[model samples]
Target: MKIVEIGTGYTQIPAKIGAATEIVIENLLNGLNNNGIEHTLIDISYSNQVKNSDKFELSLTHYVNVPNWLNKIKDNGIIHIIRRIWYSIGVGLLLRKLYRNKLQTETYIHFHNQFNFFFAYLIAGRRLRKGKIRTIYTVHSPDWSNSKKIPKKLFFEKIAILKADVIISLTNIIKDRIKESVKINSCKIIVINNGVDLNKYHPIIQGDKQKQIINIGSVCKRKNQLETIVNIKEFLLKENYKFVFAGKIIDHKYFNEIVSYIHSQSLSEHVKYIGEVKPGSELNKLYNKSMLYISHSKQEALSLVVLECMAANTPVVLSENFETFVDFDSKIRNAVKIISNHNLINEINNLCNNVSYHKQYALKQMEVIQEFYTWDNIAKLMIKKLAQFKQTL
Candidate 1:
């Protein structure tokens, strides 16, 4: 059987698909090539075309065309307003018409996030009737729904998801959220937790201690990275531990606030804002050097960074927000000390002292992940289910 997977590209040296998402498919390919399962994966391209894949039989690097008049190209925001008005009406028709002539084949739909899935559905939903293809969506995060300038676009996201033959949720928590929000047969939604490669995220054997803990993703409001820095200052007192926030600072006002907070607290030296990581080996080196990976997002589906932290054997300290954390394994939870915005110093003190505890937890969870979360295991399950689709149909 041939499997076709489409995702944002990472085949290049500096893959934009984030570490965990890239690793998931890598592990999947590892299993597939080992088992001799033939497949193809197409990376979404920037130049409005599809590129060929060496590993997969057929691949397309097609891009969603930017309407000649992209609505949100803001110099003063009128275009954004116009785009918002047009997005609701034009997306469905435009997509449907664009792919009208081509694309009649059996394939699996892979969703990197909710945006593309919605767009695919709006444009391609009508095409499903003509072919024998099965589509699935993998949730990367809770509709990260870019800049506030872009309309939430939540309504279309749900509608496109419903059109799918199957919905592949990264976690049980994610599946339940979709169920709670959208009415559909429970059987249509499958829980395929995100996977990690043991070899890649393995612990560093070198006996060295580093005072800096890295928190990835852009330094935006949702990430709540400031909480970690603020708390570290309060908890560590001497201000020894450093924070490496490695991502773009999209919001200027938010950036100012973070800068002000650091200055007001006189903790500028302790916080280092390394711009966007330039992909490849440099990122792996950054992960290796950091002792802990921390995230304090107010909301999340399941995070790629958390999995990367696990892969790097860097224990994580994440927010105990209600939306995302409920479904993690008890052991994974125990290993991580979730904070609901608490006394920063004590939390830091506890985590800093408990390196052995986290290392053991990381190792244990790695074994469980290897058995179930690998992309190969997930693809095998999908193939089996694809075969059985007719019975259910």
Candidate 2:
């Protein structure tokens, strides 16, 4: 079987260069390759240059001529270029042209983002109805939270859920959200959590790690990083642990506010901002050299970074009210310290004080990740589902 994976928004295919969706798509392609499955990736990049390599075939669409304002809107997810009339018409025509030469069941198109899902619906929905080709969509987060309260977004999400041949949910929570938004049988939805590369993100030497706490993600309000800092202010004042914040500062105002708070609290020395670090060895090193990984985000759907930390045998602290952990295995859920803003300090202190407990949880998290969250295992599950899908056809 051949698979064509369409990336969302940009052209950085199969890497950590984009969002979590892009990283997940890359890992999925690697897993498929390991299993001897042939696949292709299509994406748009910031540059007009395009090339194909032996690793995988790539088709890029560069938007250099477009106005900066339009690019900004597309980049921020306010408006997707794929959904625009001109792009949609071109994509529709291309799909129709491809349909003339390929068997419907021989090829499968997978969309990693909702915009692309809607694009597929517009371009190939009719052909899908006629069995000209199959399509699958991975819903990163059936974003039902207040942070993603865009009516238009919700509408497109419902449409994608209803229209896709099969939908993959990163967690049961996301699946539940999809069900909440629209009526769909459970059979159409498959719960497949994002996976980590244990080989790449394994534990480091004990002496190499420092008494540091790390948070990797965009420095923004939705991440709630500033609130987390406030919640643990007293703890930071007392303990020797340093708080390290990484990732791009998408919201400049929020970033400034966080900086101001840090300055006001006299935490300039204790809090370190490394800006954005490209994923790979450097990121793995950051994960490995941390005593604790914290994600104080207001919402999430199975964070790949958290899994990477667990794979590296680093225990994580998350918001007590975090809804995504409901899909984690019991052992993993127990290993992660869930504390709300009210008790963040005490909870972290408890873990920090009990060195044995910290080590125990770290080891348990690593074991759980090895058994349940590796990309190899995730790929097998996905392939099994795809095989079943083929049988039904």
Candidate 3:
């Protein structure tokens, strides 16, 4: 069977921008290829004209044209919504052409975004009854599971959930949220956690490690980087270790606020800012060299970086607000230090100062990840689920 994976086709399938969803897609396709699946990914290219080709070795990359004018608009809540709807329609047209060709093999159209699901329902819902194609959507973000977005978008998103043949939830939190909000039957929703590329991120031996702590994600309010910065200052002052904040400055005002606080507190010498390191040797090195990895995000669906750090055998610290770690096995959960925001500084210092505890902490976290969260295992689970779906057909 052939699979047509739907996503936002950037200029490249493995985009240099290192968006988490794109990285997950790239790895998921690699996993699928290793399992001997034939698939093609069709995505919206923001360029004015269509530039489609077989670019990626693992899966064919088909770039559908989206108006270049849309790319020029500065990102806002409205523009992002418009972009999603635009890509959804483009995907719908592409599928229509494919259907008209009277394709020979059974096809599975897997959607990564909720907006695409909306257009797919409008375009492919009829074709679904013809039995040539099956549709599935993986809800990768928490926003879809909750009715918290703009009402119009939420309406489309809910309809999309209702229309899909299968729904993949990245976390049980999402699955439960969907069951609660959309009232979808438990049988249709599958809880599959995101997996790490074990080959790229396994533990690495370093000659000399620094007393460095690293946080990787967008510099936005939701990420709560500023709060982490302010709270960690006393720990830095006492330990004289450096903290690296590496990610795009997504929210200018919030970023400026972080910078201002850094200067005002005279912590510039202790803190370093490396803007947006793409996933590669540099990022892996950062994960390897750091003594600890931390995230103070107010909420998350799941964090790929934290898993990458665990794979690198780095001790991790996360705020209590994160729901992802709560889903971890008890032993795995104990390996990570999840503290309330008020106690962050003390917890960080305690972990940093105790060398033996830190070493054991890293080892346990790595062990859990290796045993349970490899991309190969994740792909196998997906294949198993697909096999069951085929039997029903």
Candidate 3, residues 1-393, lDDT tens digits: the string is 777788753334666676888787777788788888888888677655434344566777766677777778776777777777787787887777677656678777888877777776687667654656878888766464334333464676577678887788877766777788788777888777788888778767767568899999988897888877777888888889888988877789998888898899999988899888978666888888888988778767778888899888788898876754236547557778888878888777777788887788888988888888888778888878877877765
Query: What ranges in model 3 sit over 4 Å off?
Result: 9-11, 46-55, 68-83, 101-106, 144-153, 324-326, 341-343, 389-393
Cα lDDT listed for each candidate: 0.59, 0.71, 0.76
TM match of model 1 to true structure: 0.76
Can you list the residue pairs that collide in candidate 3?
none
- lDDT per residue for candidate 1 within 1-393, as digits (tens), equals 545554433232114435556556555655556556665543433233333344343233233333443522443346544433344233344445544664544555455435445655555676644555566666565543221222345665565557777777766766766776677687887766555555555556675658787888876787777776776775434747788888767676887888898899877878888888754445656776776777777666666667666666566777666335447766456456576666545665655678776567667655555665555676677667665664686
Structural similarity to truth (TM-score) of each candidate? 0.76, 0.86, 0.88
Residue 198 of model 2, lDDT score: 68
lDDT of 1 at 373: 56
lDDT of 3 at 167: 83
Model 3 error, position 115 (Å): 2.3
What's the residue-level lDDT of 174 in candidate 1? Answer: 62
lDDT string for model 2 (1-393, tens) is 777776564545545452677788777777777777777666543323343233444332222122234444535433444334334344445566666554734677787666656765786677655654677878776355323233564566678778888888877766766676677877888877789876678987757467788999887877879877887778877887789989878899999999998999899988999988777677888888887888778767778888888888778998865754346667668778777677777768776778887888888888888888788788888888878876765
> What is the full ranking by TM-score, best candidate first?
3, 2, 1
Give model 2's clash tally. 1
